[model samples]
Target chain A: MVYAYLSILGMALILGVMGHRHTEVNHATVLHRAWRQLAPLLIRLPIALIAASFVGELIPQALFGEWLGERSGLSGVVLASVLGGILPGGPTVTFPLILVLERAGVGIPQLIALLTGWSCFAVHRVLAYELPTLGWSFVWRRWLVSMILGPLSGALAIAWL
Target chain B: MTVFFLLLGAAAGALLAERQGLEAVTGALLSAGELIALVIPLVIIAIVMAAYAQALLPREIVERWLGRDAGWRGLFIAIGAGAVTPGGPFMAFPLVVGLRAVGASLPICITYLTAWSVLGIQRILIWELPFFGVDFVVLRLVISLPLPLIAGITAQWLGEPGRH
Candidate 1:
């Protein structure tokens, strides 16, 4: 990370010295850009939680916990992936869910797949931005790759670990 | 449209989860809870990040590295770049779209977006290791190692727009 930062610094210096007046350049613009980028998530996450909390309050928590936990078979793996797509949250959000899934008997392999899906694809993203910008072809390309790789990764891990 | 589908899908998953077992229900709720838990923190982070993204990392930087001239090196760059590139991985979709609009290749864009979320530096160092342990994290990194390559190659192999 430090190396990356240094590299960025070096690049900035070079850009500065070369005296290339990039009218495109504005330090303030980037800061604002980052915020503009993240604003939706700020709203979306909490709403998702309120809905989820309802499920937590009403749903049969302990019963399903046993089912999804390690004891589950291949079904667990498939279930894990599907569930992953449903929950869209950050790392702090993902970890606790993983722990809970483990306690609920979600197999390790399936858990990995869930994380893979969580990490890779958000259905919301595909619609909100991916398809329009990158094209369905590009979007689908990773989805197909992930479908194969994600499960394979989990399967391999469970086998060895 | 996508949000509609996600909500619909979640609802369906909920039904299926309900039927699966007691455990599935709990797992689902936990999934839901994670989202709820993230509200405050992710929002704060998002606000800060959005502001930052607006200021730093010009459109040209994204275009230059992930652009037409980028070639194969761009593939690898896409993966590592994901972590550093700001936004919720989902939210980053828009930025990726913007990049493509500016001329990033489809393959590089796809791979980069995936790498952004899966291998993001923040998630890797801050969240994943602490939660899953070093071994699990190592395994994850190892597994994720080749993903961008696969995604990029797949996109490239499939050919350009209008081919399909």
Candidate 2:
């Protein structure tokens, strides 16, 4: 969290100087776009966070430990990978919920799997963006190869880390 | 819509907590508030920074490096460009198309996409770091860094369509 804040502050400072030098930077437009993006996030994030919090409270720690914890092994990675694909929303929505799960007892390997799945094979992203822009062939090819990433990485993390 | 579902989820959560006890509801709200506080400012700065970062990398220059004859160099270049190519799929996918039009090979393009998805600098700086903190983000990046290149190499080895 400290790193996140400090980095943002540094970026902001650097961007300010870059904008000053580049006549085309257009700070006003960037700020407007950022604010516009924030509007939707503001509504959705609060709701999701609250819901996730309550769900976290409801789920027994033992249940999460049993399913997604260290001892759950490869199956946990597989489950996390699958769930990562199904979860709605982009990073904003998924990451917060991952935090909830992490607090609830999910292991690092499973978390790695979950994040990889979401990043590589997010069904919604493929449908909405990749399909329209790159066509079905590209999507399928990418999907076939990319599917191995999450589980493979998760397994490696478990074995090595 | 996603909004409707989220609203429903929040409502259900609130109701369940209320039924369990007012204390549960209070706890949920407090937790949510704390998370929101952590996320909002980071998101704003991250998004803004990403916008700036994207602007710094000229599209034409990036595309030029992905030419068909670039070979392994092209693949490596694609991975590097993809990592820094800010914004969401909306921006990145089209950029891939642009690279293809300019004569980038299939393996290179696939590598680019994989890199963008797995090690995207913008996404990591903005979303991952803020949410998961430095240790998790760094570990994930270390593990993920070579993925796109590996995918590209594998695709090339198999003679996947467009590699030629």
Candidate 3:
């Protein structure tokens, strides 16, 4: 957490001190963009937390442990990997979700799925980021691939690991 | 208003204990607010940051490093970056997608995220080791290595279509 901040600070310092002379607006724009960068995170983080909290409460620890738990073997592995493909967003959300899901007795396989899905498939992200630039086809193709990969990879992780 | 209604529902649910309906309303309200506040914005910031990174970084640089020619170095570098790269892959992935637009390959992106989740430098250095133990950390690292590779290799193989 600190490193994330420090790195940002460091980057800012380098940009500010050495590169400031390039153009006044460039310097200002970097900072503006930085704020623009953070604006969305600040706005949405609270909501993800609240949902995760309830999800934690609703999902019975014992049941998740059984069906998708680490000890459940191949089926669990498949379930976990596929599940990973579905969820998407920041480490902030993903990490907490994983912790909550684990608290609910989610197995390693499922945990794997959650993490994988959060980062890899990122359905919402594709729409927000990639679709505009890469086109809808790239977004759909990747999502399609992720849907397949999430479960299969989890299974492989289970088998190989 | 929804929060108020939900809170009222929670109070009602608490009173009867049998009123799962009220509890449902409360939970729904909580989830709705959260979905709007957290999930929505998080995705948006992730996308914007991704856009900025895309705009800032060169496509050729990414391709040269993580492209097929990158070989083992790219793989290990990716794994290392994934492990240490802060933020969730969701946010990180936009950057990846941005990079992809700039010409990063499937494998590199996959490996980057696979490593992000599995290796997770932030989790390992900051939380897991402190909470679990060195043994646990080592076990996790040992276990995680193959997982991302499998994900990367397979995603690259199946999803990318035009590649060998």
How high is the TM-score of chain A in each model? Answer: 0.56, 0.92, 0.65
The TM-scores, one per candidate, come to 0.62, 0.92, 0.55
Flag regions of model 3 displaced more than 4 Å: A1-51, A88-95, A135-161, B1-64, B67-142, B155-164
Q: What share of the true interface contacts does each candidate keep?
A: 0.32, 0.56, 0.05
TM-score per model (chain B): 0.60, 0.89, 0.53
Lowest-sum lDDT 10-residue window in model 3 chain B: B41-50
Q: Evaluated with DockQ, which candidate comes out highest?
A: 2
In the range A38-107, model 3's lDDT, one tens digit per residue, is: 5655544444445555556665678888888778777776666666666555454565466567667766
- Compared to the true structure, candidate 2 yields what TM-score? 0.92
DockQ of every candidate: 0.23, 0.59, 0.20
User: lDDT tens digits, residues B33-130, model 1?
Assistant: 56455334433443443434434455556666776667788888777777566545454666676666666676877688778767775555434543
Reference contacts reproduced by model 2: 0.56
- Ranked candidates (DockQ, high to low): 2, 1, 3
lDDT of 2: 0.80
- The DockQ-based CAPRI class assigned to model 3 is incorrect
For residues B20-130, could you state the per-residue lDDT of candidate 2 as single tens digits? Answer: 887887877797899889888887788878777666666888888897688878888888888988888878987888887877777898899989988898788777887
Badly placed stretches (over 4 Å) of model 1 are A1-67, A73-75, A85-103, B1-54, B89-91, B98-104, B122-139
Cα displacement (Å) at residue B136, model 2: 0.9
